[model samples]
Target: MTEITLETRIAKSDEIVAGKIDDEFVMMSIDNGKYYLMNPTGSRIWALLDEPRTIGELCAVLTGEFKITAADCQKEVVEFIDQLAARQVVKVG
Candidate 1:
């Protein structure tokens, strides 16, 4: 499994096809033919992944946009991105 660091740049994996439904996101993986459901937060992250951005940048943006503390934001964002990366839902470089 790949570790997500502050410097890691992440983007949506090419194998994923996603769309929005009633304020949430639904995604399908072409590689495995699996579907995923994501909340608004995950959808926002997915949209931001349209272009490669460092994990630090991602966390900073989330912290500013959301009402979360920096420490919590870092921990949660790292874990979330790492999980998505591990599943090949997002690409990390």
Candidate 2:
């Protein structure tokens, strides 16, 4: 398993087809044939992943936009990215 750190780079998978519906971001994984629905924060993260970015960079942007502390933002973003990677919705490098 690849360990994700602050320096880890991430981006949405090419095989993912996504769109926004109402307030949710929905996506389908071509490789896995699975669907995912992301909340507002997750949607924001997905949008940010339009290009590969370091985990620390993501936390920096998210901390400024959301009402969370740096520590909490990092923790949650890491966990969220872990889930996205497991689902093959995102790739980590």
Candidate 3:
């Protein structure tokens, strides 16, 4: 199994807010004031964002849940993590 790396721990589930916009969903980190508009795949990724998970773990879960290839999940998940990290919504641990 691939090792996972979680940049930041989610402080509180309540600290995050989500809503659907058209066919997509938008999520925000209230504490950091960062906002992300996600498609279905991204939305699913956000749903599993938890304090105890890493990017790799999240990708693994995605593979199992979505029946996607590990390589594809890893690539997309890494990109998503990069964006979130850049926004300061997540930090390297």
How do all the candidates rank in terms of TM-score, highest first? 2, 1, 3
Write candidate 2's Cα lDDT for 57-76 as tens digits. 99999999989999999999
For residues 1-93, what per-residue lDDT tens digits would candidate 3 score against the true structure? Answer: 123344433222465677877657787888878777888887666667645476667866888888779888777777776666656554544
Backbone clashes in model 3, listed as residue pairs: 7-91
- Candidate 1: list runs displaced more than 4 Å: none
lDDT of 3 at 62: 85
What TM-score would every model get versus the actual structure?
0.93, 0.95, 0.63
- Order of quality (lDDT): 2, 1, 3
Off by over 4 Å in 3: 1-16, 20-24, 29-34
lDDT of every predicted structure (CA atoms)? 0.87, 0.92, 0.65
- Name the better of 2 and 3 by lDDT: 2
lDDT score for candidate 3 against the true structure: 0.65
Task: Summarize candidate 1's per-residue lDDT along 2-89 as a digit string, tens digits.
Answer: 6777898888888999998987889999999989998888888888887988888988899988999888888988889888887899
